[model samples]
Target: MQSNLSSADAVERIVGFFEHLSAADLVRIGELYSADARFKDPFNEVRGIPAIQGIFRHMFTALEQPRFVVTGRVVQGDQCFLTWDFLFAFRSYHRGVTQTVRGASHLVLDADGRITLHRDYWDAAEELYEKLPVVGGLMRWLKRRANQ
Candidate 1:
């Protein structure tokens, strides 16, 4: 049987687990997630453990030295809100350029202290689209026009 924990302990454990997450961690993801966990981010949405692991696997494949830094967090009841930064260098397209995306996650824990729903919120235009070579130019132009 899975062990249950307090919300605070669960949050702290999760933060520690995510700080060094990698392809190897996928196998142990169930340590923190229920069987039906759902995860969503700016680019992808998936449910279940395998789907969630695939997302991280793609992250490793597409980015060099990608990592997550938990800047802060708040846990209340069965829900936790976490603010974080994703740092990585594009493996091909934007090679050599280090990218950082500031974002937040809303996590819901089940009675067994396993994650049930994890949703990430970030600005694609400012954080991702603006970093691309061509799209960035157009995005900046649009921003300037809107401001003026």
Candidate 2:
């Protein structure tokens, strides 16, 4: 990872970094993001490399076999959009069943090819709450009531 990387190279590196991300790879987070990078997903919002690293660390702690499968990517200059499926099983419950959460990330890369802005978009209610054991029932009921 270099600061002079082209946008295409940067995007490719990001996709590959996520698809093969592991706890061991957490040490290389700075290779993908700038020191002052800002990251925001449905659950958390933080800036800087350490805070972003904490998010990934928490993911590994809270989920079982958490992984990302990138489906598509679009790049325009310094901005890139990636569509991906996040697959994981709950460590607390439903340990045998893997869940998929479809989402997209909007990223802005710095001149050095490191991510300066990372924002993830997804439906927390439909993708997450609807998959929980107890909350799933209530979420489904609410969805059906709203649809009707």
Candidate 3:
């Protein structure tokens, strides 16, 4: 966190960091999050900068060209909301087909402008499992059955 950083500045930095995130940028995770920051998404929940870095590292290993395109944002005091599209290609399955997962993040910044809480909202069944091979068929069938 930078000294005397404002809440808006912190939100901007966080958005940019995620938009251009890479494996090498993992080292800079502390710049955006507090040492004991908590992060939670659909599949995983963890605390601390090191744990956050591990999650991003696994993303790089699991996908090809994974990136986030921020579509919109809203900031209120120390809280921020960001809507984005996560684009990537499966390394083992549909290697060449790009997949997009639309999601939003809720971030709370500390006084020094470091994120203390990061929560991501996305539908894993519709965005992820429905794109897989065998699981995709099952997921689609299940969705149809539920809809009917």
Candidate 4:
């Protein structure tokens, strides 16, 4: 059997996934993930819902009022690419070092309408490393040198 859904519909579903995320809802992550789901990023290569939920929980703790706002999204077949801005404040850092990181995630949906593979592509050096005090200065210097 074949199902037909528009690209806009797929993108809506992807956006809904992030919009409905709540700290307590981490337990229901399995409902959105395939049995053999895989998630990859620069810092993590996690598989399965449990591992993904662990990362989400960590994110909840690490960022104060962390929320993902979808700026744009595109879908083609079973794959959806979403651009988003993450707004959060890290309490561990200085008193007023809140961060807004812009990034994108590519999600592949399974036949059962669950996310099978999720890959996030973003510049860590620019979004994260460059936000730090000392590291930011060093990264900026390195970037200047590389561009020269």
lDDT of 2 by residue, 53-146 (tens): 9999999999999999999999999999999999999997888699999999999998888999999999999999999988999999999999
Candidate 3: segments with Cα more than 4 A from true spot: 1-3
- Tens digit per residue, CA lDDT, model 4, 2-86: 3464545655765787876789989878877887799998789999998999888999987787888889887777888888898
Colliding pairs, model 1: none
TM-score of each: 0.94, 0.96, 0.96, 0.89
TM-score: the better of candidates 1 and 3: 3
Tens digit of per-residue lDDT, candidate 1, span 1-148? 1346788888888999999998788799989888999999888889999898888888888889898999999888899999999999987776877899999999999887789999999999999999888999999999999999
**Per-residue lDDT of 1-148 in model 3, one digit per residue for the tens?**
3458888888888888999999999999999999999999999999999999999999999999999999999999889999999999999897889999999999999999999999999999999999999999999999999999
Off by over 4 Å in 4: 1-10
Q: Evaluate all candidate structures by whole-model CA lDDT and list the values in order.
A: 0.90, 0.94, 0.94, 0.82
lDDT at residue 115 of model 3 (Cα atoms): 92
Measured with C-alpha atoms, the lDDT of residue 40 in candidate 1 is: 92
Relative to the unseen true structure, what is the Cα RMSD of model 1? Answer: 1.9
TM-score of 4: 0.89
